[model samples]
Target: MRITGHHPLWRIAAAVLGGYAFTWGFIALGMAGAFALGMSFHDAEHLTAIIGFLIYLVLFLWAFAARSLARVWAVTAGGALVMAGAASLIQHQLT
Candidate 1:
Protein backbone atom coordinates (compact mmCIF):
# COMPACT_ATOMS: atom_id res chain seq x y z
CA MET A 1 0.00 0.00 0.00
CA ARG A 2 1.22 3.42 -0.91
CA ILE A 3 1.27 5.88 1.97
CA THR A 4 1.11 9.49 0.90
CA GLY A 5 0.97 12.86 2.60
CA HIS A 6 0.88 11.81 6.22
CA HIS A 7 0.19 14.68 8.61
CA PRO A 8 3.37 16.65 9.25
CA LEU A 9 2.68 16.40 12.98
CA TRP A 10 2.56 12.63 12.77
CA ARG A 11 5.78 12.64 10.83
CA ILE A 12 7.40 14.84 13.45
CA ALA A 13 6.22 12.62 16.30
CA ALA A 14 7.46 9.49 14.58
CA ALA A 15 10.78 11.11 13.85
CA VAL A 16 11.23 12.26 17.43
CA LEU A 17 10.36 8.86 18.86
CA GLY A 18 12.64 7.18 16.39
CA GLY A 19 15.46 9.51 17.30
CA TYR A 20 14.94 8.96 21.04
CA ALA A 21 14.96 5.21 20.66
CA PHE A 22 18.09 5.35 18.56
CA THR A 23 19.85 7.60 21.07
CA TRP A 24 18.90 5.43 24.03
CA GLY A 25 20.07 2.32 22.29
CA PHE A 26 23.42 3.91 21.51
CA ILE A 27 23.81 5.05 25.12
CA ALA A 28 23.12 1.52 26.34
CA LEU A 29 25.78 0.19 24.00
CA GLY A 30 28.22 2.78 25.27
CA MET A 31 27.49 1.79 28.85
CA ALA A 32 28.17 -1.79 27.97
CA GLY A 33 31.47 -0.74 26.42
CA ALA A 34 32.40 1.14 29.58
CA PHE A 35 31.76 -1.97 31.62
CA ALA A 36 33.94 -3.95 29.26
CA LEU A 37 36.65 -1.35 29.64
CA GLY A 38 36.48 -1.64 33.46
CA MET A 39 35.18 1.88 33.90
CA SER A 40 33.09 2.41 37.00
CA PHE A 41 29.85 4.35 36.86
CA HIS A 42 30.92 6.44 39.84
CA ASP A 43 33.75 8.00 37.92
CA ALA A 44 33.60 11.65 36.88
CA GLU A 45 34.48 10.53 33.34
CA HIS A 46 31.35 8.45 33.24
CA LEU A 47 29.31 11.56 33.96
CA THR A 48 31.08 13.37 31.17
CA ALA A 49 30.30 10.53 28.78
CA ILE A 50 26.64 10.71 29.73
CA ILE A 51 26.66 14.44 29.13
CA GLY A 52 28.10 13.88 25.67
CA PHE A 53 25.38 11.34 24.98
CA LEU A 54 22.75 13.90 25.98
CA ILE A 55 24.28 16.40 23.58
CA TYR A 56 23.98 13.87 20.76
CA LEU A 57 20.41 13.11 21.81
CA VAL A 58 19.48 16.78 21.59
CA LEU A 59 21.12 17.04 18.19
CA PHE A 60 19.13 14.06 16.96
CA LEU A 61 15.88 15.53 18.28
CA TRP A 62 16.59 18.84 16.63
CA ALA A 63 17.26 17.12 13.33
CA PHE A 64 14.06 15.12 13.61
CA ALA A 65 12.01 18.21 14.34
CA ALA A 66 13.36 19.76 11.16
CA ARG A 67 11.23 17.20 9.27
CA SER A 68 13.74 16.44 6.57
CA LEU A 69 14.91 12.82 6.44
CA ALA A 70 18.03 13.73 4.50
CA ARG A 71 18.92 16.40 6.99
CA VAL A 72 18.13 14.01 9.85
CA TRP A 73 20.41 11.37 8.41
CA ALA A 74 23.18 13.88 7.86
CA VAL A 75 22.87 15.18 11.41
CA THR A 76 22.65 11.70 12.90
CA ALA A 77 25.68 10.50 10.99
CA GLY A 78 27.58 13.66 11.82
CA GLY A 79 26.70 13.26 15.48
CA ALA A 80 27.91 9.69 15.46
CA LEU A 81 31.20 10.77 13.95
CA VAL A 82 31.52 13.54 16.49
CA MET A 83 30.75 11.13 19.29
CA ALA A 84 33.46 8.80 18.10
CA GLY A 85 35.87 11.68 17.81
CA ALA A 86 34.89 12.84 21.27
CA ALA A 87 35.52 9.38 22.66
CA SER A 88 39.03 9.38 21.25
CA LEU A 89 39.62 12.86 22.60
CA ILE A 90 38.38 11.83 26.02
CA GLN A 91 40.66 8.83 26.05
CA HIS A 92 43.63 10.99 25.16
CA GLN A 93 42.68 13.61 27.73
CA LEU A 94 42.16 11.09 30.49
CA THR A 95 45.30 9.11 29.90
Candidate 2:
Protein backbone atom coordinates (compact mmCIF):
# COMPACT_ATOMS: atom_id res chain seq x y z
CA MET A 1 0.00 0.00 0.00
CA ARG A 2 2.27 2.73 -1.25
CA ILE A 3 0.16 5.81 -1.04
CA THR A 4 2.74 7.97 -2.67
CA GLY A 5 1.45 9.76 -5.69
CA HIS A 6 0.08 13.14 -6.60
CA HIS A 7 0.52 15.67 -3.76
CA PRO A 8 -0.55 14.13 -0.52
CA LEU A 9 2.07 16.05 1.37
CA TRP A 10 0.90 19.34 -0.01
CA ARG A 11 -2.67 18.54 0.83
CA ILE A 12 -1.78 17.70 4.39
CA ALA A 13 0.23 20.88 4.68
CA ALA A 14 -2.62 22.94 3.36
CA ALA A 15 -5.10 21.22 5.62
CA VAL A 16 -3.08 22.04 8.69
CA LEU A 17 -1.05 25.17 7.99
CA GLY A 18 -3.33 26.80 5.46
CA GLY A 19 -6.40 26.02 7.50
CA TYR A 20 -4.72 27.60 10.51
CA ALA A 21 -3.89 30.76 8.61
CA PHE A 22 -7.40 31.05 7.22
CA THR A 23 -8.93 30.48 10.63
CA TRP A 24 -6.68 33.12 12.14
CA GLY A 25 -7.80 35.59 9.52
CA PHE A 26 -11.41 34.71 10.15
CA ILE A 27 -10.96 35.33 13.88
CA ALA A 28 -9.25 38.62 13.25
CA LEU A 29 -12.01 39.85 10.98
CA GLY A 30 -14.72 38.56 13.25
CA MET A 31 -13.19 40.23 16.25
CA ALA A 32 -12.78 43.56 14.53
CA GLY A 33 -16.22 43.56 12.96
CA ALA A 34 -17.91 42.47 16.13
CA PHE A 35 -16.12 45.04 18.20
CA ALA A 36 -16.94 47.78 15.70
CA LEU A 37 -20.55 46.70 15.79
CA GLY A 38 -20.65 47.35 19.56
CA MET A 39 -19.81 43.91 20.85
CA SER A 40 -17.77 43.91 24.03
CA PHE A 41 -14.08 43.13 23.63
CA HIS A 42 -14.21 39.88 25.60
CA ASP A 43 -17.52 38.95 24.02
CA ALA A 44 -16.20 39.40 20.53
CA GLU A 45 -13.05 37.53 21.35
CA HIS A 46 -14.94 34.59 22.83
CA LEU A 47 -17.47 34.52 20.04
CA THR A 48 -14.91 34.54 17.29
CA ALA A 49 -12.78 31.99 19.05
CA ILE A 50 -15.71 29.62 19.23
CA ILE A 51 -16.64 30.11 15.57
CA GLY A 52 -13.04 29.89 14.47
CA PHE A 53 -12.76 26.33 15.77
CA LEU A 54 -15.68 25.20 13.66
CA ILE A 55 -14.32 27.07 10.68
CA TYR A 56 -10.94 25.41 11.05
CA LEU A 57 -12.54 21.99 11.15
CA VAL A 58 -14.52 22.68 8.01
CA LEU A 59 -11.53 24.07 6.19
CA PHE A 60 -9.35 21.16 7.23
CA LEU A 61 -11.85 18.65 5.91
CA TRP A 62 -12.42 20.67 2.76
CA ALA A 63 -8.75 20.82 2.06
CA PHE A 64 -8.57 17.06 2.06
CA ALA A 65 -11.78 16.48 0.14
CA ALA A 66 -11.26 19.23 -2.42
CA ARG A 67 -9.97 18.13 -5.80
CA SER A 68 -7.85 21.11 -6.57
CA LEU A 69 -4.93 21.79 -4.30
CA ALA A 70 -4.32 25.06 -6.08
CA ARG A 71 -7.81 26.26 -5.31
CA VAL A 72 -7.53 25.20 -1.70
CA TRP A 73 -4.25 27.00 -1.29
CA ALA A 74 -5.54 30.05 -3.11
CA VAL A 75 -8.72 30.31 -1.11
CA THR A 76 -7.03 29.69 2.18
CA ALA A 77 -4.11 31.99 1.57
CA GLY A 78 -5.94 34.63 -0.42
CA GLY A 79 -8.97 34.66 1.82
CA ALA A 80 -6.71 35.04 4.81
CA LEU A 81 -5.08 38.07 3.28
CA VAL A 82 -8.39 39.63 2.33
CA MET A 83 -9.94 39.03 5.73
CA ALA A 84 -6.88 40.22 7.60
CA GLY A 85 -6.73 43.29 5.42
CA ALA A 86 -10.36 44.02 6.11
CA ALA A 87 -9.70 43.63 9.83
CA SER A 88 -6.82 46.02 9.58
CA LEU A 89 -9.00 48.60 7.84
CA ILE A 90 -11.66 48.19 10.47
CA GLN A 91 -9.14 48.67 13.23
CA HIS A 92 -7.83 51.79 11.56
CA GLN A 93 -11.29 53.22 11.25
CA LEU A 94 -12.09 52.40 14.85
CA THR A 95 -8.94 54.04 16.05
Candidate 3:
Protein backbone atom coordinates (compact mmCIF):
# COMPACT_ATOMS: atom_id res chain seq x y z
CA MET A 1 0.00 0.00 0.00
CA ARG A 2 1.20 3.47 -0.80
CA ILE A 3 0.86 6.46 1.42
CA THR A 4 -0.79 9.68 0.29
CA GLY A 5 -0.53 13.32 1.34
CA HIS A 6 2.33 14.46 3.52
CA HIS A 7 3.85 11.58 5.48
CA PRO A 8 4.97 12.30 9.01
CA LEU A 9 8.21 10.41 8.59
CA TRP A 10 9.08 12.31 5.47
CA ARG A 11 8.39 15.61 7.18
CA ILE A 12 10.70 14.67 10.00
CA ALA A 13 13.37 13.59 7.60
CA ALA A 14 13.14 16.81 5.70
CA ALA A 15 13.43 18.77 8.90
CA VAL A 16 16.56 16.94 9.95
CA LEU A 17 18.32 17.15 6.62
CA GLY A 18 17.26 20.71 5.92
CA GLY A 19 18.38 21.84 9.35
CA TYR A 20 21.91 20.60 8.80
CA ALA A 21 22.07 22.06 5.33
CA PHE A 22 20.84 25.37 6.66
CA THR A 23 23.55 25.43 9.30
CA TRP A 24 26.36 24.53 6.96
CA GLY A 25 25.09 26.99 4.39
CA PHE A 26 25.07 29.74 6.97
CA ILE A 27 28.52 28.77 8.17
CA ALA A 28 30.03 28.86 4.71
CA LEU A 29 28.30 32.04 3.58
CA GLY A 30 28.65 33.81 6.90
CA MET A 31 32.32 33.11 7.27
CA ALA A 32 33.01 34.04 3.69
CA GLY A 33 30.92 37.17 3.86
CA ALA A 34 32.52 38.24 7.10
CA PHE A 35 35.97 37.65 5.76
CA ALA A 36 35.19 39.59 2.61
CA LEU A 37 33.96 42.45 4.75
CA GLY A 38 37.23 42.32 6.73
CA MET A 39 35.71 41.26 10.04
CA SER A 40 37.95 39.46 12.51
CA PHE A 41 37.46 35.73 13.02
CA HIS A 42 36.02 36.09 16.52
CA ASP A 43 33.51 38.72 15.50
CA ALA A 44 32.47 36.86 12.36
CA GLU A 45 31.94 33.63 14.27
CA HIS A 46 29.58 35.31 16.72
CA LEU A 47 27.69 37.07 13.95
CA THR A 48 27.14 33.92 11.95
CA ALA A 49 26.04 31.91 15.00
CA ILE A 50 23.23 34.33 15.72
CA ILE A 51 22.15 34.51 12.11
CA GLY A 52 22.17 30.74 11.74
CA PHE A 53 19.87 30.28 14.70
CA LEU A 54 17.22 32.58 13.29
CA ILE A 55 17.43 31.09 9.81
CA TYR A 56 17.18 27.52 11.12
CA LEU A 57 13.92 28.24 12.89
CA VAL A 58 12.37 29.61 9.73
CA LEU A 59 13.65 26.77 7.58
CA PHE A 60 12.45 24.12 10.04
CA LEU A 61 8.92 25.45 9.93
CA TRP A 62 9.01 25.86 6.19
CA ALA A 63 10.08 22.26 5.69
CA PHE A 64 7.01 20.94 7.45
CA ALA A 65 4.60 23.36 5.83
CA ALA A 66 5.80 22.75 2.31
CA ARG A 67 3.47 20.77 0.04
CA SER A 68 5.92 18.00 -0.88
CA LEU A 69 9.01 16.37 0.53
CA ALA A 70 10.87 16.65 -2.74
CA ARG A 71 10.17 20.35 -2.96
CA VAL A 72 11.54 20.93 0.51
CA TRP A 73 14.65 18.93 -0.15
CA ALA A 74 15.27 20.60 -3.47
CA VAL A 75 14.89 24.09 -2.10
CA THR A 76 16.98 23.31 0.93
CA ALA A 77 19.69 21.68 -1.10
CA GLY A 78 19.64 24.41 -3.73
CA GLY A 79 19.93 27.14 -1.13
CA ALA A 80 22.83 25.38 0.54
CA LEU A 81 24.63 24.82 -2.73
CA VAL A 82 24.24 28.43 -3.75
CA MET A 83 25.54 29.68 -0.45
CA ALA A 84 28.45 27.26 -0.51
CA GLY A 85 29.36 28.30 -4.04
CA ALA A 86 29.26 31.95 -3.09
CA ALA A 87 31.52 31.24 -0.16
CA SER A 88 33.99 29.46 -2.40
CA LEU A 89 34.11 32.33 -4.87
CA ILE A 90 34.53 34.89 -2.11
CA GLN A 91 37.27 32.88 -0.44
CA HIS A 92 39.07 32.51 -3.75
CA GLN A 93 39.07 36.25 -4.23
CA LEU A 94 40.42 36.81 -0.76
CA THR A 95 43.42 34.56 -1.30
Candidate 4:
Protein backbone atom coordinates (compact mmCIF):
# COMPACT_ATOMS: atom_id res chain seq x y z
CA MET A 1 0.00 0.00 0.00
CA ARG A 2 1.25 3.40 -0.94
CA ILE A 3 1.12 6.14 1.64
CA THR A 4 0.82 9.62 0.24
CA GLY A 5 3.31 12.19 1.46
CA HIS A 6 0.80 13.95 3.65
CA HIS A 7 -0.65 10.71 4.88
CA PRO A 8 2.74 9.36 5.86
CA LEU A 9 3.43 12.57 7.72
CA TRP A 10 0.39 12.01 9.88
CA ARG A 11 1.25 8.36 10.32
CA ILE A 12 4.76 9.26 11.41
CA ALA A 13 3.43 11.73 13.92
CA ALA A 14 0.94 9.18 15.21
CA ALA A 15 3.67 6.56 15.49
CA VAL A 16 5.83 8.92 17.53
CA LEU A 17 3.00 9.86 19.86
CA GLY A 18 1.73 6.30 20.13
CA GLY A 19 5.22 5.03 20.83
CA TYR A 20 5.73 7.63 23.54
CA ALA A 21 2.43 6.67 25.11
CA PHE A 22 3.30 3.00 25.02
CA THR A 23 6.68 3.64 26.63
CA TRP A 24 5.17 5.67 29.45
CA GLY A 25 2.43 3.10 29.97
CA PHE A 26 5.00 0.33 30.27
CA ILE A 27 7.07 2.40 32.70
CA ALA A 28 4.03 3.01 34.87
CA LEU A 29 3.19 -0.67 34.82
CA GLY A 30 6.76 -1.56 35.70
CA MET A 31 6.73 0.83 38.62
CA ALA A 32 3.44 -0.59 39.80
CA GLY A 33 4.74 -4.12 39.49
CA ALA A 34 7.79 -3.22 41.51
CA PHE A 35 5.65 -1.69 44.20
CA ALA A 36 3.43 -4.75 44.30
CA LEU A 37 6.53 -6.92 44.63
CA GLY A 38 7.76 -4.81 47.55
CA MET A 39 10.74 -3.58 45.59
CA SER A 40 11.64 0.07 45.60
CA PHE A 41 12.57 2.02 42.47
CA HIS A 42 15.87 2.75 44.19
CA ASP A 43 16.86 -0.88 43.78
CA ALA A 44 19.29 -2.02 41.10
CA GLU A 45 16.58 -4.18 39.49
CA HIS A 46 14.89 -1.02 38.29
CA LEU A 47 17.73 -0.51 35.82
CA THR A 48 15.95 -2.81 33.40
CA ALA A 49 12.99 -0.49 33.39
CA ILE A 50 15.11 2.42 32.25
CA ILE A 51 16.68 0.37 29.45
CA GLY A 52 13.32 -0.88 28.28
CA PHE A 53 11.92 2.62 28.10
CA LEU A 54 14.85 3.86 26.05
CA ILE A 55 14.53 0.92 23.66
CA TYR A 56 10.86 1.60 23.14
CA LEU A 57 11.50 5.25 22.44
CA VAL A 58 14.20 4.45 19.88
CA LEU A 59 12.06 1.86 18.13
CA PHE A 60 9.18 4.26 17.90
CA LEU A 61 11.35 6.90 16.34
CA TRP A 62 12.72 4.35 13.89
CA ALA A 63 9.22 3.32 12.90
CA PHE A 64 8.10 6.91 12.51
CA ALA A 65 10.96 7.71 10.12
CA ALA A 66 10.33 4.64 7.97
CA ARG A 67 8.98 5.16 4.47
CA SER A 68 6.76 2.07 4.25
CA LEU A 69 4.85 -0.23 6.57
CA ALA A 70 7.22 -3.09 5.92
CA ARG A 71 10.20 -0.89 6.48
CA VAL A 72 8.72 0.45 9.63
CA TRP A 73 8.04 -2.99 11.03
CA ALA A 74 11.44 -4.27 10.05
CA VAL A 75 13.28 -1.36 11.56
CA THR A 76 11.28 -1.33 14.74
CA ALA A 77 11.55 -5.06 15.27
CA GLY A 78 15.24 -5.09 14.51
CA GLY A 79 15.83 -2.25 16.89
CA ALA A 80 13.88 -3.98 19.60
CA LEU A 81 15.80 -7.19 19.16
CA VAL A 82 19.12 -5.43 19.24
CA MET A 83 18.16 -3.43 22.27
CA ALA A 84 16.84 -6.43 24.13
CA GLY A 85 19.92 -8.46 23.32
CA ALA A 86 22.24 -5.71 24.42
CA ALA A 87 20.33 -5.16 27.62
CA SER A 88 20.36 -8.85 28.43
CA LEU A 89 24.06 -9.16 27.80
CA ILE A 90 24.85 -6.12 29.89
CA GLN A 91 22.64 -7.22 32.72
CA HIS A 92 24.12 -10.70 32.63
CA GLN A 93 27.61 -9.29 32.91
CA LEU A 94 26.64 -6.91 35.66
CA THR A 95 25.10 -9.64 37.76
Candidate-wise lDDT, in order: 0.56, 0.95, 0.83, 0.57
Candidate with better TM-score, 2 vs 4: 2
> lDDT per residue, candidate 3, 1-95, as tens digits?
34666577777777878777867887888988997898998889888988888888888898877777788888788888888888889889999
**1 or 4, greater by TM-score:** 4
Task: Write the residue-wise lDDT of candidate 2 on 12-92 in tens digits.
Answer: 999999999999999999999999999999999999999999999999999988878889999999999999999999999
After superposing candidate 2, which stretches have Cα over 4 Å from the reference?
1-6
For residues 19-80, write the lDDT of model 1, one tens digit per residue.
55445445544654564477785563475467657865676567545656656655555555
Off by over 4 Å in 3: 1-6
Q: Candidate 3 — what's its lDDT? A: 0.83
Q: Per-residue CA lDDT of candidate 4, range 1-95, in tens?
A: 56676877666754675555555544544554555556765652475467657857776676666667665654444544554555455445545
Q: Pick the candidate with the highest lDDT.
A: 2
Q: Give the TM-score of candidate 2.
A: 0.93
- The C-alpha TM-scores of every prediction are 0.45, 0.93, 0.83, 0.51
Q: Model 3 clash pairs?
A: none
Ranking by TM-score: 2, 3, 4, 1
Q: In model 1, where is the ten-residue run with the lowest total lDDT?
A: 20-29
Backbone clashes in candidate 1 total 0
